[model samples]
Target: MKKEIPLAITFISGVLLVLALFIPHKPFGNLEEIFNDWYIIVSGFTFLLGIDSLLGYNFGKLKRKEKDAPYALVLILSFFITLTWGIVEIVRTPEHNPFGPTSTFSLYFYNSIFIPLQATMFAILSFFIASAAYRAFRAKEINSALLLVSAVLVMLGRIPLGQSAAPYVITVIFLIFAVYFFAESAGVTEPKIKIAYILVALIFVALIYPLGFVYFRQHIPEFADWIMNVPQMAGKRGIMIGIALGGIAMSIRIILGIERTYMK
Candidate 1:
């Protein structure tokens, strides 16, 4: 009975929410407002539930004397401290608290703790990326080799040297990277020709690149931007479509009451 009741509610609410979009008048005119109110109520309760779960988790860890117990304790203390400060501010100046995104507590926390921690994370991420890229760019497989080659092109076209290089010079360098990588898989079978191909390209760049930079340094960043805006945007759009379709399927599942995981 308990499960059936919630499932029925989900199905009806989901249908009504969908209907409200297309039929926003008369019998269902107020569905949007009604549903939004319900959402606000549920969200309030959900926030409290999340807080309860967070504390319960850390308390359990503390009780068990886990090796990471200190971090758990810090998490608990930080949550309560931030919550208490924000709550106190809200109660003290209800009207102003609406704009309290700039409140002293908010500003202090964002600048002193949040921003510094976020910057530190990015700094750590750079080293992790370098190591991962080293492992990935070994050209072990066709796919990884392609990824490595594309990545190298993108990187070369992005940095100051690439940015300073002349337009034609940059294009030639990119072509060389592609050709050199392909020489590995194409059964070229001739080592001397492959070596000569790369060495000649390098020598050419070494000689002409400075002249190109002196004359055409302005076009390097533009070339990189073109690659990203054209090819990268196409890939991103395809991914977004996939995400939207997945969301629609999930919504249908919920509306049909096939997704009961949320109730549990």
Candidate 2:
């Protein structure tokens, strides 16, 4: 009954929220606003749960005398120091906040700790990309060769000098591929070879287009503006739709207690 009641509430709430988007009238609109407020309140409570879990895990490691216990202690110490500093600053000067100029305890910890950690994590991903690319290009087949060539062109095309040279090179490359395609269609080339060539050529074109557009933007602005507004906006909209659906799914799971791994 506990599970069934929560699941029923989840399903009903999900449908109403989705429907509220289409009907921008009276109670529906008010209900959506109420839901938004509820979400904010729930999130605030969830944040405390997150902080408790973080502290608990780190403290457990310290208690067990784990190998990485020192690192966990460092993290906990930093967290408490930051929290204490913020609380002291907030309490000391109610009339004029000590953290007014954005040089506060919270901001300092975020800039020093959070930003650098995120950058370090992202930088580490480059090694994985290199490893994957090395594996991908090691195949000796025609298709693999084409893939390797396309990847090299893409990497080259990303650089400043290569991008500058891409427009002239792109035109010649396209013409060569077009001739090869026509020849294959007219029975002058083998089907397999033609297919490989066409695939490589299309990949090259895909890489070249961005470079070419950037190059052309120095001479003509309208084309660049169109690419940014039309294609980029379409891409953004697609991403937003995916994000909305993902959030809805997550919310449903949370409300129904289906995603209770966090509690553990």
Q: Please report the candidate that would top TM-score against the real structure.
A: 1
TM-score of 2: 0.58
Give me the overall lDDT of model 1: 0.76
lDDT per residue (tens digit) for residues 1-264 in model 1? 988898888889888888878996876988888778988999998988898898999999999999999999999899888888888888987765622566888778888999999999989998998999899888767688677756755676777676544456545645665466555535556878777666755665565545345534655456557778988889999999999999999999988888778887
Off by over 4 Å in 2: 95-103, 140-143, 163-264
Q: Write the per-residue lDDT of candidate 2 for residues 33-115, one digit (tens) a residue.
A: 89989999999999999999999999999999999999999999988887788778878766645445554665766778788
Q: What is the lDDT of residue 241 in candidate 1?
A: 100
List where candidate 1 sits over 4 angstroms from the true fold.
24-34, 79-110, 166-222
Q: Provide the TM-score for each candidate, comma-separated.
A: 0.65, 0.58
Model 2, poorest ten-residue lDDT window? 216-225
Native-structure RMSD, model 1 = 5.6
| The candidate that achieves the highest lDDT relative to the unseen native structure | 1
